[model samples]
Target: MSTYKAPLADIRFALYDVLGAEALFARLGFADASRDIVDAVLDEGARFNETVLAPLNRIGDEVGCVYDKTSGDVTTPPGFKQAYAQYVDGGWAGLTSPIEFGGQGMPHAAGVPLKEMIDAANLAWGNFPLLSHGATEALLHHGEAWQQEVFLKALVDGRWTGTMCLTEPHCGTDLGLLKTRATPNADGSHAVNGTKIFITAGEHDFTDNIVHLVLARLPDAPAGSKGISLFIVPKFKVGKDGVVGERNGVRCGAIEHKMGIHGSATCVINFDDAQGWLIGEPNKGLAAMFTMMNTARLAVGLQGLGLADRAYQNALRYARERLQGRSLSGPKQPDKPADPIIVHPDVRRMLLTQKALTEGGRLLGYHAATLVDVVGHGADEQERQQADALLGFVTPIVKACLTEWGVECTYHALQCFGGHGYIAEHGMEQLARDARITTLYEGTTGIQALDLMGRKVMQLQGAGLRVFLGMIEAFCKEQEGNEALHEFVAPLRAKAGEWQQLTISIGQRAVANADEVGAAAYDYLFYSGYVALAYWWARSVAAAETSSQSDAFKAAKRETARFYFARILPRTQAHAAAIGSGAASLMSMDVTHFGG
Candidate 1:
């Protein structure tokens, strides 16, 4: 099986050197989140993930999760429960949760490295606690004080895991069609009744009680999305004092037997008049749920980044060791019968593709995390609002691009192994399979595209886009005199202008035809993503040139930045051209003529 290791050096460089995360954290009132403390956290997170979780990845995939249909219980693969225990013991669960609720209260950015480590080590196991962040966000933002005391503490301290119950069998993206009902009781609680599908960690052996942030409808509520309400339901009932009580009406009907992340239970949860408490105001569940969804969307982006990094790491190792045909330039390893695959230009292309995407994606994902911190704790209200808008703009790009690139990177990684990658023993296939789901879940790439083009850019009038373009322009101006950065800075500045023009053009066409948004959305998301990476890549090169990093490290950053600009950045051209084509061709085709 291929081994896994956290890319600590690259992670550190991105967080501290490239992003200047420490200074930002200090300025945002995260005084306790000093470089030393955050560094130590990274070290321990790496050790725990690499030693405890990495070894379990193969076993988890192999054994998968076991479900007792009769009892409605799910038993996670062996070693998962133990690793989670270690995680809780180490205080990793509440690393970024509020201090008042039994948490360490670190900056959100500080948790990004730890999250990346967990995902790279074991994504399936990571899914078990993944929704906890969203659950915490939902409760912290919308739940009642008593609900926080009862449910939030357990989830924060890792005494219990959490799940976001959004998708139902009848409705996936359209929550308005959901049939889940929440009937009011005289005791001020609600009885939730309905079935939720694809509920990650819906039922697990790691914790006794699973806190479910469910979406349902009130009896007298209006129709459609606006009428939905959010509720807190648990596997086992609890009281105001926080003591676990009798089992609730909720039960795991079944677990999905499918493509990947087999160790993570994707359960069909049934709430048969389950005891629940209302969260936020009536008919405002969708808005409240966005609090959780926004968190999950960013975390899903990190999942893609982590898996891509893992795939790249293994592919690089294989290219160096797996001897193949001699290079056209002549055998570099004359002592061996044939040269290693790394000597071949085609192999280099694939490797470099993986490297460029993985590294550039790291900066993109981490920068979003930093924005989360700024949105939450910026000193000035205007600064916080601007950060929030920027975060909204990039969230879709980060989610869609990282995931689509995750699938792309893993495919290239497997191809690097030739026939060997297809086999289970090498573990490349599992990574590929696992990467597929990231794009599908947490809102599909298509959903994110519409969100970006239809809502963020057009409806919100490009508030987030303007902020991002300003950053790129300001960066280019700041580094104009630095000749070493001219190669990347010049093109990046031009791309920023093109990005603005592209947005304006799309807005103009959208005024005449509404279908223009859908047609331009997918291409526009990728276009935005590639240009965003261009800015980050430029910044990465500039940061590496002056940092105290090793000579080899510095050179690698510079060369990779060059490779990205030369090969990957041009992908934006294709996307832009496609966007320029307008929506006529797409909408002109009649439904009856689709087969033709």
Candidate 2:
């Protein structure tokens, strides 16, 4: 069986040493987020997830969720409820929420490490509360005062869980095709009639009332996505007095039999004239929903990072123990029948790839999380705006790359196990299965790539890219004199220059032919990601050199940085070449002849 232990040391190293998150929290007026307090939180979170949630991972996958056909109820896997209760009791649900709404008011970055621990410990189980973060963001940003009083407190305090109900049977990516309708009622509320599919935590026994942030079209609203409106539709209706009342006109029609994350209940939620209140202005629902979606996109990125770390952990453990062919040099362990598989060069390659990606991804995800704090509570308006731009730009990269890499790392880890990885006993296959969903959900890699290229870079005039490139230039200049970082600095500087030029080239081509954007988008996103990670890996080495980390730990950082630069950073070349190839090859084939 596989086991998981939170990489607390590395997590702290990333947060405090690499990102300097503690100082950022201090500057942002997060009084309760001092290093001491954050440390305590991390330690406790590690204990809770490692002990309570980690043990239930296999069981969660094995048993999955149970649905009652007659009652339209869903029961999560065993120990899930108990674990969630502990989680709520420990005040984890509101760790990063506003204090005014019964939360701890910690910086969003402070919560990321704990979130990573939860995901790594048990991903399916972690899905239960995952949507709540997005829901909380939607209500906080768009919901009215009354709505906040009635719904936000429950969600913040963990008395109830929340979900984002957007996708329907007819619509997954395109929200404009939605058929859900909402009609204003006599009591100042609306009657929401819709069927939303693939709603995570849509129906579960963890909470008595499930708050769903539903997207539906108001009557007389314009057509397409503009007609949409965000609504607060709870499973159990709540009154002004904050009392949970009778059941609303919502039920779980069914749950999906997914490829993985079986412990999570993905429900087909049907709302039959459910009493609902509008979250924001009518026909402005997509903007409000995006408030949730953006938050979710970041969280989903962490999910990928977490799963990859877990897979790497288990694979590393297995490789150290599993004896295989002798080392190429000779039998170092002559007493044994053969040396461990880890002695093989191929195995080391796979393990290092996982390490490089996960550790580098931690910085990428954590820095984005820090931007959440900065955008919300920056020292000045310009600071907040820049952070917002950079965050918007990085969100897609984090979501797509980390997730795609999650699938990659899991595959590598499973490969390390050889045939044993295929079997269920080693628990490697489950990780592989769970990692698959992160890429497909939230947004697929293709969608993210398009968003990064067409929307962020093209539409926004590369505001975020400008900010990121500036940082790279400054870092490169600062490190130019340091001989230790000379190798990484020059290459990173060159890549940064190339990245900027690549963006310009794509934009120039896109001006003439729109298809150029689509053709170059996927490759462009990945190229950006590889270069972005290269910067982080180099900074990681610089950070380690100055920190008080043990000599061995510091050496590991240098070696990993070396490996990443030499072996992994070269991936940018292929992506850049693909982008240079342009839209001709992609658009040349006739559509009708493609099926053959």
Candidate 3:
């Protein structure tokens, strides 16, 4: 059996049962997005992912991507262009784009789950289109009127693709040291020059043109990140009549040999005075670029969750079918040559861990996606602001925690397959390798932790934290008598309380000691992530209790929740202790200490 299925029931449960996605859609006046429409969309998305995309998984990994310097073009694995053509023909590329831009205008919540399914089926293939979505988001928010009119339609229709060019050899996380430059031309345009490395989908054959949203410093601008500006640099320049024009100065210097996601092209692009148009106001490029980064970060978290889900599905299938030693209680399958591995307690433990985390991650991702919709279309300004603030707080947590656990979950899933897990045939190893990049790209886990603690929490004066805690507290109050769910909620509340106190303590300490914040940041972010997942699980359990208690559905929910609290939730204690210990230990370690 393949590791790809619709997971339709679970998706429905999360969307309608737990997250109230249906009501939110109706309340937001998205009248066309009814339950039937949503289900149909999901079903079609699943079918495409399972059938059209899943076949490319192994082939893409094996063939990877090839760059021909002489031709200045990157070739995708066999059948990728055909698959992408089908994807575009079906209008999947514009599923959530604005209606004015020739898109379906569906809510992000609807589109994101579809994205997860595709990513789970084949992460490497999914990344190209995923990056395009990020670029589209940046353009929609920050692009000028003419720029939007000229580019948004083609982008939304998938006639063109997009990429974000920010990272350089000297600057990855530290954009302040970025050396790319944009010099003003006689006309309103600018001449972009410099090289950008680690650019995903930087150059590809998937579309007619590639729109690059590049970050560069203008001449006579101030030093550091403050002087940077965003520009639209198309691979093939667009003329006044919207026709493809001459090739711009940009060229792919080389492609990197990476650990994973080899199917997605990561190129070193050299921009030698390329014609470019500035995006947004001068010196506000960071803000515009962040529009893409924040979206990409969440998408990366979804990538992590998708990989975990796929790994778990594959592992579960293997466990149930692979015969091994007899059951602990004696031969229930005595008639057979051997019992299946699923009969063993340890195998069950690993499977349960994967299920709990993947399901929990899905719930969290869908919840966050709903918040994006709320922030975009909510009735009240305060509601939108609150959603924005809370989302900002959880963004780093979602990215860091999900990606980290995704790698762990995939590893455990591989372990379930024994020797076969390591083999490329089963595709388990590929899942783990592909998952590794989710943590590294978007932002490393350490960078995410710093963003959470230093920017989201400390700089915002804990406004986001208070909003999140208040919501959790209100939920606890509402469900005080919910015995079915209180078992999950009570522990969650206590853990969340500990987390809040820990945050307060750390925040206080960091004021007097900058090192203290850095030291505790990662641990604090992780602890908070656990707390967040626990809250999601609790809500899921409560929703399950209120639903018609079909034995299979209710039993799975309860079992998954039990597995989470018993095995997964306990790790937060370690994170809390580590955070409480402060930065002194980390700072005091001498260089010689590592030599031993």
Candidate 4:
């Protein structure tokens, strides 16, 4: 079975050495959380994921979740319940949750790396707790007093799990056409009646109770998204004493048979007059849900990074162990039957590409996490606001770019294993399949592009763009003295400048012509994603250069940075050119032009 060892040293280097996460943590009033505490948490997280959760990945995928229609009960794969119990016992579920609700209240920076470790170990098992964390975030942000007291504690403590109920059969992205309805009862509660499809962790036996943060429309509400309201609909009703009471009106109608992540129970939830309490204000559910949606989007990006890391590790190990053809120049190991695959230039290329992207993604992911912490707990309001604006602008890029790169990285990793990759035993196929969804869900790549070009960039009038460019410029200025980093830094700055010009041009055309935005949106998003990754890689290279001369780690960092610039970063050129080419060619062709 494939197992994961958390990249502790790399994480420390990124957090303390590169990003200055420790200083930021202290400044943000997280003074109690020192380096020792962080190390202990990470160590515990690594052990738990490797020993308890990682081993069950394949088992869960094989057995999956079974639902008995007559009994209305869901049984998880073997050992899942025990593993979940262990997860709760270790307090892994509340690593970043608020202390007021029985949580540890650790900073987001601390939580994110731990999340990556678990996700890399087992994407399927990792999902069960992930959804719950998202739900807790939503509830804490939008849930009312009574609702928080009842549901938040259970969720934070991992005694209960949660799922977001969106994406109906007829409507997925277009929530304006959704048919779910919530009717107000004589009591203070509302009766929710709707069918929510593609609900991850919708039905499971991992926890005693399941809390659903659902989106539905009130009976007398206005039409479209404006009418939508958020609700806390639980599987089992909670009594005043904080115990599970009667079975609620919610139940799993059916479970989705998916291509990957089979261990996660994706359900068609039937809410037949399920008693629920209102969260936030009526007709503002969409806005409220965006809070959870945005967090989920970032988490989804980490999912991509995690899978790519695992794929790279597995492939790297295989390359070192599986002897293949002799060296093209000459045999280095003359006594052996064949040289290790890692000795080949092409194999090295593939592994280096994976290393560059995955490592770069880890740094970027941690940066985003720290941004969230700064936004929430920064020393000053101005700093908080800046962090908020920057994070809001980059969330789409982080989600779309990282996941897209993740799938590409996984593909290369699988190819490294050759025929063994196609087989189930190797687990490469599963990693690829699991990664495929990250780009599709939490808003598709096209949707993210539209959000970036249409909403974030064009709408902000370069405010957010200016912030990003300013940061890049400052970094370049700081590294100007470093000879080794100059090569990577200069190209990154040029790419950023080119992308900025392209973005402005696209915005200009999009304003005059609505159709142009649609045509240029996808390419523009890809360009932005590429440029953002390049910036991250450049900074990583600079940090890696500062390490002690005797340490070979700096060499690894430089090699990965070189790989990124030579192989991966060049793709942005094509994406930018496509964005600048306008929307006519793609939209001009008729439906019957080439197809029957």
Model 2 earns a TM-score of 0.99
Summarize candidate 1's per-residue lDDT along 55-108 as a digit string, tens digits.
999999999999997999999999999999999999999999999999999998
**Which stretches of candidate 3 lie above 4 Å from their native place?**
none
Worst 10 residues of 4 by lDDT: 542-551
Looking at candidate 2, the ten consecutive residues that score lowest on lDDT are 236-245
- Per residue, candidate 4 scores C-alpha lDDT tens digits across 1-596 of 45567777888888877888778888888865788899899888888877887888888888888988876677888988898888898888898998899988889998888888888887888888988988998889888787789898889999899898989999999998889898898877889998999999998888778999999998888998888999889998775456677999998988878888888888889999998888899989997689889999999999999988989988999999889999999996889999999999999988998888888888878889999999888878888877887898888888997898889888998999999998888888888888898898879998998888778877777566778888999998888887877888899889878877887787788777888888888887777777777888888767776754335887777777888889888888788778767888787889899887
Q: TM-score of the candidate numbered 1?
A: 0.99
Model 2, residue 199: C-alpha shift (Å): 0.5
Colliding pairs, model 3: none
Model 3 TM: 0.98
Off-target runs (Cα >4 Å) in candidate 1 are none
Candidate 2, position 496, lDDT: 97
lDDT of each: 0.93, 0.94, 0.89, 0.85
Write the residue-wise lDDT of candidate 2 on 1-596 in tens digits: 77899999999999999999888988899999999999999999999999999999999999999999999999999899999999999999999999999999999999999989999999998987889888999989998998898899889989899999999998999999999999999888899998999999999999899999999998898989889999999998877677778899999999999889999999999999998988889999999989999999888999999999999999999999999999999997999998999999999999999999999999999999999999999989999999999999999999999999999999999999999999999999999999999998888999999999989999999999999999999999899899999989999999999999999999899889999999999999999999999999999999999999999999999999999999999999999999999899899889997896
- Candidate 3 or 4, higher lDDT? 3
- Write down the lDDT that model 1 would get: 0.93
